[model samples]
Each structure stands twice: as structure tokens, then as C-alpha cells.
Target: MQINQTQSDGLKQAFSVTLPFADLEQKRQARLVELGRTIRLPGFRPGKVPMSLLQKRYGSAVMAEVADESVNEATRQLLSERGLRPAMQPKVDLVSAGEDKDLEFTLELEVLPEIEVPNLGEITLTRLKAEPGDEAITQGLDNLLKSRRKEIEVTEERPAAQGDAVVVDFVGRIDGVAFEGGTAQDVPVELGGAGFIPGFAEGIDGISVGETRTIKVTFPAEYGSAELAGKDAEFEITAKGLKQFETPVADDALATELGFEDLEDLRKFIKDRLQRELDSEARQNIKRQLLDALADRISFAVPPSLSESEFTQIWNRLEEEKKAGRLDDADKDKDEDTLKAEYRAIADRRVRLGLLLAEIGQKNGITVSNEELNRAIFQHSMMYGARQQEALDMFRKNPQAAEFLRGPIFEEKVVDYVLELAKVEDKPVTAEELAAAVAADAEG
Candidate 1:
């Protein structure tokens, strides 16, 4: 076996590997022996098949398999000997191959940067002191109660009006053709809700029970259904009932229905939940400040390869945003040099911080444990309204998906460890001050 470096860049290595024919033949024969033991034929016994027959039947497949193994082995050996780590999978090209001739291939890989992490103690950061107040908790509780409040039927002979919810059956038509999701039966729609088309809901106002009417509406130009956009449609409606707004009183009885002992218990729960949110936000702010300070503390330049990848990712996003006319107002006015300098700086900082956190995690033996992974999986499932078992199965069946759950856990643990040694001061500041400080750091 021989490996020769054909080209070298800052963080890229291109190598050509050659294995003598003798070694190739050895691996091929070994594979053939294994195949013969398991392979059965009508005429040949499983374990007693002739080597010539095996070679004739499975030689090409065995050769390809051995070549793949050889490439993997040679690449691993090369990386280990040179103390290099690949940033991504190496691209392997089979340059030459034959039954009796030596095997030859070329491997190209982007190597991980050689990063020297700065001392954590030297890093400076600030953490804001804040917690959700009673007012916020009360507001949140009110919102929850409102969402769960039920609407009851109104027994009145008056005509349906705006701000009233009317029970009706309606059908919509576009160019005399009814499309999917264009009609509803006995549906309750709030007059002037702006939920339905502009004129459709208003036409329901002053409608009487058992009354049938035709309402016309023009779909918005940017409606999701392209075929209906900027088109006129008629909804034939028949009102069956009406309802008036009713909010439950904020009392102990209402709280009991919400699975709580009383209103006070509910308020306590809300306060606790709000405090957790505030604490999480505080941690995030500290982490951002810590990252920025760490970037300033580091002195070495990031590997050009890593920086290029990072910059390219950010640059591509900016281009996409520009095309959509969604570029930030502040960024829109900036010149190319200014934008490049700002974004390149951001890319450099992110790469440096990522490299530093990875090194720290490795040195401290920090790992993504199963418990943390389950928590991540559970949270992700909650985002999509999924059952716990369903999300777990999704993660377990897809190794790549499970791997995605690991990175954040590892990074968070490393951040916590660094914060332990870091000079993170709890500078008591108002919400406005904290927001300004975080925004300034983001701009930088």
C-alpha cells in the first residue's frame, strides 16, 4: 500500500493511493471464500462450491466491494497518519483497476481546521437580570382562558349583524366551476371577521334566520389559490342560527374547569411558565454575549476553507433575500464593501465560535445524552402537534434525524461549561436596556 499527496491547499488535501496486485488478490480471494460458504446453487453444495465457479459467478461484484473497502481503509489510514480530520466525506475516484494489475485511486477531502481554543477564563460576558412579572402572567392566563372559551347559541329574533357569528351553509363558485375547499355546510362564520373574503362576510350582516342570499366577493390578488386570485366569486348562503360573544368570568369556577384548583393556582402556573421563558431568554442573551466576547478574545485566523463555506452560505441567503426584496432596511442602504465586511465578519465569528465550542466539548468529555436527546425529540414533536411515540419513531428510524438532535445538546452543554468559568456578570438592567444591548451585539 502506498499513498502520495498530489496537491495541497490551506485546508484541502488531494491524494493518490496505490495498492499492489498481491494485496488486492488476497482481499478478493477472501471475499470469494466467504461468498462461496453462504451461496447455494442447484448443482453446487453451499460450502463445497469450487473457487473457479465462485470467481466466475461473483468476481466482478466482489472486486467492486473490495475496491470500496480499500478506498475507505486507505483514506482512514492516511488521515490517521497525518493527524487530519475531514470536514465532509472524501470524494474518491477509481483511476485504474484490473484483476492482476495494482489498484489506483484519487481521494480529495476538505480537512477540519486546526483550531487552538482560547482560554475560557479570559472571556468576558454580561447576563441580564429579568423575570416575567405578575402582569405578564395574568395576561397570558387571560389569553389561554379566551382561547378555551366556548361560544353558545343566542336565542333572539333579531337579524344577524356585524361582530355576530352566524351559522350558515354556503357554496362558492369560480368562473362557474366549483373548486376544492370552496364550500361549507352549516358553518359558523363571524360577520366582518376578515377571515372570509372582504365582501362575503359583510353580506351576512342583517341576514335573518332561514334566509337565503347570494354574496359576491373578489379574491385578493395574492391569494394562496392562484386560480382564484383577483377573480370574482359568489357564495350562496342560508343562515340557520346566530351567536353572541360571551367571555367566562375570571373566577375560581372558571379556573376549575381549566384543570386547576382555582384562579390563584392558575395564575401561579402562568407565572412559573413565564419565569421559565424569561430565564431561557436570559440564557440565550448571555450565550450570544459570550460568543461575541470569545470571538474578540481569539487571535488566530480561521481556516480559509471553513470561512469560505460559512461566507458562501450567508452570501447565498442574502442574494435570495435581495431577490425577494426582503433585505433588511438597514442592510439595503449599505454599499457592497460595507455589506461584505459586515457579513464576512459575522461568518468569521461564527466559525471561530463553533470551532471553539467543539474543542471545549471534546476536551471536557461532554456528550449528548439520551435524556437530553429525548427532550429535544419531544419538543420538536410538540412543534408539529405530533404524538410522543410517533416523533420518537421518526427519530429512531432515521439515523440522520437522530444525529440532528445531538448537535444542539452538545453545544448547549459546552456553553454552560464555559459560562461556569466565564466572567458573566448579572448586570441588572431594564428590558429596554437588555434589548438594546442584544441588538447592538447583533449589529456588530
Candidate 2:
């Protein structure tokens, strides 16, 4: 057996491997012997077949199997001896293989670049700290009250105004033909609320009981229903009843109605919930800043294979978004070349950062525990609600599917380890200010 370096480029290496026919014949003979032990013939007992007959019948087939095994073994030996970590699977090209000839193949692979882990202490980051303000709590409470608000019937005949709920029978038609899910009776619609088409709710404003009108609306270009998207339709509406939401009073009565003990208790819950949200936002902002800082501090060539793979995934998603008419406004004006260039840079950065974090985690012995993985699986399954058990079973049965959860947990563990060593200064800001900072970070 012999190995020769064929090519060397940045993070890419190619090699030529040759195995002597003697080694190939030895492996083939061993495989034949193993098969002979279980062999059965019409006139011969098991393990009694002649060597020449076995060789004559299965020689070529066994040699082919031996050739495959030799390629894999040679590739592994090459990587192991060279101390090379491939970014992706090594490509093997069988150059030569035949009877009584030396086996030869070329191995091409992009190796993982050597990453230098930066000093976490030297990397400084400002972690935005935001606490929910009184105003925010008040707003949250108001939202909760609105969510729980009840409607009261208006006995007297009156026109439905904005914020008023109206009961109506309606049939929506596109091209003079009523569509599926287009007709309904006595549906309560809030005149100024969302959920209806762009102009459907507003068109109901000032509609009086017993009045009938045709409201025209165009579905959004990105509407969920592809058949109805961006199409104009007319709804024939007949107003039947008028109703108004009861004015909400944030008192003990309201709290009790919400299944809380009192107004103070409700306020405490809101405050706690708001604080949790703010904490989450802060954590995300800090992590993003940390990642950005690390990216700026480190510079290394990423394996082209990894970068290209990442770019392909990003480009595919961008294409899907463009097709769905949901492309980002900022990206809408960019040409194909410009978009590709920009996203390719993003892909390169992502790959580089991923490699850096992995190196750091490896050096620091950071790992995700089985318990943490199980907890993550449980949390994921909970998203399925009633099918949580089924989700759990699927994840348990599919190791590959569950393995997807490992990356995030490992990355988070690495980030947390870095955060512990890094100099993160807490900068207190309002929730709005923190949000603005995060948005600015994202845009930048």
C-alpha cells in the first residue's frame, strides 16, 4: 500500500492511493473462506466445497466487494495518517482496478481549516439590560383586558361604528361565483378589528341593521390561500344586529374574572411575564453581540465546501421567499448578482463562526448532556399540543431527527461558556431602546 499527495490548496487536499494486488488477493481469499464456512451445494455438505470451485463461482464478486472495502480502508488510513479532518465526505475516484493489478484511486476532500480560538476575556461586549417599565406593564394589562373583553348586545337600532361588533350574513364571490368558505350566517365581525380582508372590516363601518351592501376587497398578495391571493372579491353583506364590547375596568372583579386572586396578583403576573420576555430579549441581544464580536476578532479561511453548502441553503430559502412574494423589503431592490454576493458573504461568516465556536467548545470540553437533550426533546414535543406523545415517539424512534436538536444545545452551551469568560458589561436600557438596539444590530 502507498499514498502520494496529488494536490494541495487552501483547506483542500487531494491524494493518490495505491494498494498492491497481493493485499487485494489476501482480502478476497479471507472473504471467500468466511463464505465457504456457510456454503451448501447440491452434492457437497456445508464447508466441504472445493476451494477452486468457490473461487471460480464467487471470485469476481468477492473481488468487487474487496475493492470497495479497500477504498474505504485506504481513505480512512490516509485521513488518519495525515491527521486531516474532512469538511464533508471525501470523494473517491477509482483510477484502476482489475485482475492481478494494483488497486488505485484518487481521494479529494476539503479539510477543515485550523481555527484559532480567541481569548474570550479579551472579547468585550455590552449586554443590553432592559426591565419592563410601569407603562409597559400597564399596556400589557390593557392587552390582557382587551383579550378577555365581552360583547354586549345593542337593543336599539343603530349603525355599527368602528370598534363595534356587527352580526351579518355574507357571501363572498370572485368573478360572480361564490367560493369555498365564502358564505356564512350571523358571523360576528368587529368593524375595526383584524382577521378580515383588508377592506372587509372597515367597509362594515357605519352599516345599519337591516341594511345590505356589497363590500369589495382584495386579498393580500401573500395570503395563505394561493387560489384567492391577490384576487379582488365582493362580499354581499346583510347587517342583522349591533353589539359593543363592555368597557373593561382593571379592578379586582376583572382579575377574578381572569381567574386571578386580585388586581395586585394580576399585575404581579403581568410584571413577571414582561420581565421574562425582556430577559429573553436581553439574552438574545447579548448573544448576538458576542457572536458579532467574536466574528470580528477571528479571521480564518473556512472550508469552501461548508461555505458553499451554507450558501446553497440560504439561496434556496431566498428563492422560496421571492417566489412567495415575501422577500425582505431591503432585498427587493437588489439584483441577482448583488443578492448572491451579499448572501454568500453571510454564508461564509456563518460557517466561519460555526467552526470557531466548535473549536472553542472542543478546547473547553463543553458538551450537551443527555438530560439536556431529553429536556429539549420534551420542550419540542410540547409544541405539538395533543400530539406531543406522537412527536416524542417519532423523535425517539428517529435518531437522526433527534440529533438535529444536539447542534443548538451544543452551540448554546458553547456560547454560555464564552459568556462566562468574556467581559460582558450590562447596559440598562428601556425595553423600546433595547429593541431598537437589537434591530440596529440585525440591520448592521
lDDT (0 to 1) per candidate: 0.82, 0.91
lDDT of each residue in 1-444, candidate 1, tens digit only = 888899897777899999887897899999999888899988987799999988998899898888888878988898899998887678899899987889999999878777777778977777897767667777897788667767878887889876689999988887777877888898888886757767887888899898999888898765656567688988889999998777678889988987899989988888888767667667778888787677777765576667878999999999877765566768979998999999998888888788888988998899888888878887887776647678767888886997787888899999999999988778786655666666776665
For model 2, how does the per-residue alpha-carbon lDDT over 75-114 read when each residue is reduced to its tens digit?
A: 8988998899999999999999999999999999999988
Q: What is the total number of backbone clashes in candidate 2?
A: 0
Q: How close to the true structure is residue 174 of candidate 1, measured as C-alpha lDDT? A: 77
Q: lDDT value for candidate 2?
A: 0.91
Q: Give the candidate number with the greatest TM-score.
A: 2
Q: lDDT (0-100) at residue 29 of candidate 1?
A: 97
For this target, which candidate reaches the highest lDDT against the unseen true structure?
2
Candidate 2: Cα lDDT at 253: 92
How accurate locally is residue 249 in candidate 2, as Cα lDDT from 0 to 100? Answer: 92
Query: CA shift at 268, candidate 1, in angstroms?
Result: 1.3
